[model samples]
Target: MSHLSRTLPIKRAAHVYLVHEGQLLLVEERMDDGSIFYGLPGGKANAGETLGDAAVRQVLVETGLRVTDLMFVSLIEGELLTGTRNECYANFGRFTASFSGDLAPTDPEVVGVKWVPFEQVEGLVRYGPPPEVEERNPLIWVPTRDFVRGQPRAYYPI
Candidate 1:
């Protein structure tokens, strides 16, 4: 078999939008330069698992929170090359839900959790580490922020 055939493909993932008050819940990704970037709390599905269930499980794993009233939202998906490995990330039925419990990072990669102001998305996307990464992933915070602020445009690829 060719090397490409031997390589693995990341087929699916589920991320959640957890909002409370005027802020959105996010997990920290500390870059090599010590700058903090944020992403939603969720991950890929295991074999024979459902997306919503995976969302619930991943949220609990990453943030130690329980989510309820899962409502489907926009889907952001495409294929990309990550360090010479071609992977397709298809996130179907992205969800928003109400969460409760004290936040904690059970995953080592998640060093911290915070409720970022909805407005921070603009700056994070505009001035984040390399515009290239931002372009690859759209301004995801927009939809969640709008939804939180009750200004409409909740589900989005913006």
Candidate 2:
């Protein structure tokens, strides 16, 4: 029997951070009941697709942007309670990418897309939580900030 059968269902997700002039591209999505949330532009990788390709495709689909210059940033393993799949554990690849295109929302996953100055994201995130709330909340992040300040990228489980 395959060892996959004995392990908890594992889901792969990519998060693309589109940075330009110290700002980051973001998606604002609405739930069926009209609640709103914020998130980076990315999604699941298709079968046999590289994480880089998945990030590029997801950015274009979710935010109507063509992404290039992708770089791997961090690998995160955590517990996420996404509504569609409440897996207790998930592994995620976070990437930094450069993109160019008219700002628009193309995929149904996003209701709005925009660029926000990085420094101001904390305030915005405080009010507009990410879609995968338990997974992508800024409150749980420390890697990028720490890395910039020459600190280690060690993440403590919350």
Candidate 3:
């Protein structure tokens, strides 16, 4: 482990890969700089909450969807850097989830909810899994396809 890993705080997040009919569920938000950002329907886990529970709760709040049968697919560990300094370590748990319900965003930060076509996802999502993670685990990040359910979970460090 590097010095930063030993010194920096860790932030644990849970994100879902909710695919239906070749489209993925995405939450659209406006960043501080007024740029639009598209990301998965989940967020950081709350205190004392399991990652799976966080995933379900975040999905419900962000997309009005009830998710179930979560299958763990990947774990991505990376540093959230501020220029040359390491700010915090990000540990993200990625899951493939089964969800039901219509699209409705309840979160105030969420400006919209979209079902992006699989092929268009890569170009649309500005904040995504790190490149190292995506390159090593194409099945998890590839824009045109979904990872197989029950596939062995993979770990990527960035």
Candidate 4:
């Protein structure tokens, strides 16, 4: 396999959007450079882990919240461009789940956590959708907004 294709599965991750009263549970991820971006609480899944388990673990670890009553909402897949050049990192299999728990920041991975009103996510998106993404990039919002709207399809490269 080519170098690009060989690294296609490097960054597989999952996210859970715990919505209650039109608010989304989001995490302020801290970049190595001290910048931040807001996004649903989640992280990488362990080997052979189920999507649901990954969702719950990520949410609890990042936000100090236990996700119960969770349900599969959507499936998202797309390319993730890290700081690495021409790497073509694949951050596919983004999924959203519903759940409930007291909101708090539980993991050091996140700089901060907040429950953003659904209407406000757009503003956050404009400011840099998620710290996992390259700041000031428009592609970050493409998958997030689609997930929020119950449409998880990513625009596959043509």
Among the numbered candidates, top TM-score falls to 3
The estimated TM-scores of all candidates read 0.72, 0.75, 0.79, 0.72
Candidate 3 per-residue lDDT, tens place, 1-158, comes to: 45663667777879888988878888888766677777788888988988999999999999999999999877877765534343567777888888888888799999999988766777774543333322223332432233422233467665
What's the lDDT of the predicted structure labeled candidate 3? 0.73
* Candidate 2 lDDT tens digits, 21-84: 7777778887655776667788777878877888888888898888888887777665555344
Q: Which 10-residue window of candidate 1 scores lowest in summed lDDT? A: 127-136
Candidate 1 global lDDT: 0.67
Which of candidates 1 and 2 reaches a greater TM-score?
2
Query: 2 or 4: which has the higher TM-score?
Result: 2
Clashing pairs in 2: none
Candidate 4 error regions (>4 Å): 1-9, 82-91, 94-98, 126-137, 149-158
Which segments of candidate 3 are over 4 A away from where they belong?
82-86, 127-153
Each candidate: RMSD:
5.3, 4.7, 4.9, 4.0
lDDT of 4: 0.65
Q: Rank the candidates by TM-score, best first.
A: 3, 2, 4, 1
